[model samples]
Target: MALNIKIHKADNRGKADYGWLKARYSFSFANYFDPLRERFGVLRVLNDDIIDGGGGFDTHPHNNMEIITIPLKGALEHRDSMGNSSVIREGEIQYMSAGIGVQHSERNFSDSEPINLLQLWIFPKTKNTKPLYDQINLEGKRIQNSIQTIVSPEGGKDIIKINQDAWLSLLNSDAGLKHKYELHKPDNGLFVFVIEGETVIGANIARHRDSVEIKGVEEITLTINAPSKLLLIEVPED
Candidate 1:
């Protein structure tokens, strides 16, 4: 089948700054509304956020949403009503199944260093399930110069489980590197997020913070133009 691709440039994303925090929304979020960019398949929210030292989001509530947090730099202090509290830093991914409802708070753990992270919200396959929290440390487990699964459905090896059939993988490679990503489900679509550096997806170039939504193809090829970090999400299109 032929592939269909749509690119979302970094600068085109919605931006918000509040002194202590700076955020770029890939989809409609908070006050950054865009009718055309509301969502991509089951992927609801993707926010690139930077929090200054000692600054962070206050307690908030979420329900029926699969929340994933990827720390790019520094550390994030998390505390929830489930009596779970911990600090998640770079090289780590956190998952929170806010089934039914949950109240949580995330703050910068460092008093001097800023924290950069990606927050993703995926619609769950089922509603009113039990809330849960988990984190995965990717220190030595992640595959170098290739894509590695960070989040997947239960029964996957060494992966954080989510309440959906989606799969989330991380790719880190140097310039001139080439890789291929195969879809787990034929009806699913892939959302490629350029976390750092640049890459060529099909005929288009995606720079830092840019994203490419792809569908129809069974696999997609990526060419790294520079040392790059990417997040590939495969989720149900319908």
Candidate 2:
């Protein structure tokens, strides 16, 4: 049997309020550290950030990793050293491959509206490929009663592609709807993050900011209790 570890709904996640930026992390990061909770599998970081109007993170450098950005509300203005500058709105996802090294900046485009986004970083199998940028939009489509799929490995109809053997699925779910995720490839595992509302995973319940790590299972089920949203990442278990 595979291991089933469920993280319950709790307010124990580390929080940092900078007035302009409000972030809640499930794992200890930077100034926030919980010896019990750090990271899971190849999924290293999950930062739920809310940037205030006209506020954003300045240029930063990253290397030898896959960085994904998903904006849930408002628009984000992005500029990279690779000469990629664009505006990402809700329903859109951006994937940046920091293979060697890259410098970038992210800012909320609206002066009166803040931007809510989730930034994820995954460790790559091999480092130093090449720095790249791409994005995809998922709008007006329902997947298992939800709306989301901004990134995938196979490069869906309009999704951005990454080098790693991983996939990201987002859903805006309806109550009573159950969604099952079956393993698509061997040596892979799934990480589920609750973005909004409430949901039940296996025999446990998870609320906002709660997460669960499942491995060696052929498939798992999810039941939404209300109109909710969530992110599912499928990556190598090892």
- Backbone clash tally (model 1): 0
Local distance difference test, each candidate: 0.94, 0.82
TM-score, cand. 2: 0.92
Poorest stretch of ten by lDDT in candidate 1: 149-158
Q: Best candidate, TM-score-wise? A: 1
Question: Could you tell me which residue pairs clash in candidate 1?
Answer: none
lDDT tens per residue, model 1, 1-238: 5689999999999999999999999999989999999999999999999999999989999999999999999999999988899999999989999998999999999999999999999999999999999988888787889898888887356699999989999998989989999999999999999999999998999999999999998988999999999999999997
Give the residue spans of candidate 2 off by over 4 A: 8-10, 142-149
lDDT by residue for model 2 (179-226), tens? 877767767888888888788887878887788777778788888888
Question: After TM-score superposition, what is the CA distance of residue 113 in candidate 1 from its true location, in Å?
Answer: 1.3
Looking at model 1, residue 125 earns an lDDT score of: 95
Residue 137, candidate 1: alpha-carbon lDDT: 86
